[model samples]
Target: MSNISIIGLGGVARAIGARAIEGGNAVEVIGRDAAKAKDLAAALGGGATAGTFGATPVGDLVVLAVPYAGAVPVIAQYGDALAGKVVIDVSNTSNADATGLVTPDGTSGAQEIAKAVPASAHVVKAFNTVFGHILAQGGPLDVLFAGDDARAKASVSAFIESLGLRPLDAGGLEVARWLEGTGLLMISLARHGVGNFNFSLGVDLPG
Candidate 1:
C-alpha cells in the first residue's frame, strides 16, 4: 500500500481520502485549518491522521487537492520537503466563468507546479477531469494523468488501479495543457444538455 498525503479538506480531498483508505493505503490529511483537518481525518476513520500544513508530508505521494490558484503557494511552502516524492496536481487552470483556460498557450498548471517544486520532486497531473461527487459515489472511472517522470507515473498509476479505476497515460508533462482543457470541456458539457456533474470523461475501448 502507498502512503498518501492529501493537502486540502474540501469535497475532493475527502473523497480521495476515503478511496485511498479503501484501497488500503495510509492517508494523511493536511489543511490550512488544523481543526478542519482533524475533523476530516476523524470522519474518514480509517487510520487517517491530520498533518501540519507546510510541513514535510508523510506520504510518498502528495495530492494537491486545492484550486489552481492555491497550488503554487502550497508548492513553495512545501519546498524541499517534497523532494524525491511524487506530487500529483489535480487543479484545473480555467477562467472564472470556465469558458476557457486561464493559463497562456503552451503552459499548464502541472508544468508550472513542476517548475516550482524541487528538482527531485516528480510532478504528475491526474483526476482533474473527474468530479468529487463521482469519486464519493465509488464509480469506476478513468483517471487521465501526465508526467515527465516514468517512475512517478507508474506509482500514481498503481494507486489509481488500487481504487478499482482505470489509469490513462496521456503522455508526458506537456500533455497537461490538454488535460486541463478537457476539464473545461467537461464543465461546459455538464452545464448544457448533459445537465449533471455525475458523468466522467472516458474512452470506449474495444474489448
Candidate 2:
C-alpha cells in the first residue's frame, strides 16, 4: 500500500483520499485550512491523518487535487520538499465558463507545474478527466494520464488499478494539454449534449 498525500480538502481531494483509504493506502490530507483538513481526515477515517500545508508530504505520492491556479502556488511552496516524489497533477486549465483552456497552446497546467518543482520531483498528469462524483463511486471507469516520467506513470497506473479503475497512458507530459482539453470537452458535453453529470469520457476498443 502506498502512502498518499492529498493537497486539498475539496471534493476531488476527499474522493481520492476515500478511495486511497479503501485501497488500503495511508492517507494524509493537507490544505490551507488546517481545521478543515483535520475534519476531512476524521471524516475519512480508516486511520487517515492531517498534514501541514507547507511541509514535506509523508507520502511517496503527492496528489495536487486543488484547482489549476491553486496548484501552481502549492508546487512553488513545496519546492525541494517534493524531490524524488511522484507528484500527480489533477488540475485542468479550463476557464470558468469551460469555453477554452486558460493556458496557452504550447503549455499545459501539468507542464507548468513540472517546471516549478525540483528536478527530482516527477510530475504526472492523472485524474483530471474524471469528475469527483464518478471517482467517489469507486467504479469501472477509464482514467487517462500523461507525463514524461515512466516510473511515475506506472506508479499512478498501479494505484488506479488498485482502486478498480483503468488507467490509460496518453503519451508524455505534453499530452496533458490534450487531457485538459478533454476535460473541457466533457464539461461542454455535460452542459449541452450530454445534459447530465452521470457520464464519463472513455475509449472503445475493437472487439
Candidate 3:
C-alpha cells in the first residue's frame, strides 16, 4: 500500500483520502487549518492522520488537491520539503466561469506547478477530469494522466490502480495542457450537452 499525503481539505481532497484509505493506503491530510485537517483525517479513518501544514510530508506520493490558482503558491510554501517525492497535480486551469483556460497557450497548471516545485520532485497531472462525488462512489472509472518522468508516472499509475480505476497515460508534461482543456470540455458538456454531471470521460478500446 502507498503512503499518500493529500495537501488540501476540500471535497476533492476528502474524496481522494477516503478512496486511498479504502484502497489500504495510509493517508496524511494536510491543510492550512489544522483543525479541519484533523477532522478530515478522523472522517476518513482507516489509519488516516493529520499532517502539519508546510512541513515535510511523510508520504512518498503527495496529492496536490487544491485549486489551480493556489497550486503553485502552495508548492512554494512546501519548498524543499517535497523534494524527491512524486507530486500529483489534480487541478484544472479553467477560468471562473469554466468557459476557457486560465493558463497561456503553451503551459498548463501542472506545468506551472512543476516550475514552482523543487527540481527533485516530479509532477504528474491527473484526476482533474473526474467529479468528486462520482470518484467517491468507487467504480472502475478511467483516469487520464500526464507527466515527464516515466518512473513517477508508473508509480502514479499503480496508485490509480490501487484505487480501483484504469490509468491512461496521455504522453508527457506538454500534453497536460490538452488534458486541462479536456477538463473544461467536460464541464461544458456537463452543463450543455449531457445536461448533468452524472457522467465521466473515458475510452472504449475494441476487443
lDDT of each: 0.94, 0.91, 0.94
Report the C-alpha displacement of residue 29, candidate 3, in angstroms. Answer: 0.4
Off by over 4 Å in 3: none
> What RMSD does model 3 have?
0.6
State the displacement of the C-alpha of residue 59, model 2, in Å, after optimal TM-score superposition.
0.5
Q: Candidate 1, after superposition: displacement of residue 105 in Å?
A: 0.5
lDDT of 2 by residue, 91-207 (tens): 888998899999988999999999998999989999989999989987788999988988888999998887778899999999999999999998999999989988987889999
Where is model 3 poorest over a 10-residue stretch in terms of lDDT? 131-140
Question: What TM-score does each of the candidates earn?
Answer: 0.98, 0.97, 0.99
RMSD of each: 0.8, 0.9, 0.6
Model 3's TM-score against the true structure: 0.99
Q: Where's the lowest-lDDT run of ten residues in candidate 2? A: 157-166
- Candidate 3 lDDT over 1-58, as tens digits, reads 7999999999999999988988999999999999999999999999999999999999
Which candidate should be chosen as best, given lDDT against the real structure? Answer: 3
Query: What is the number of residue pairs that collide in model 2?
Result: 0
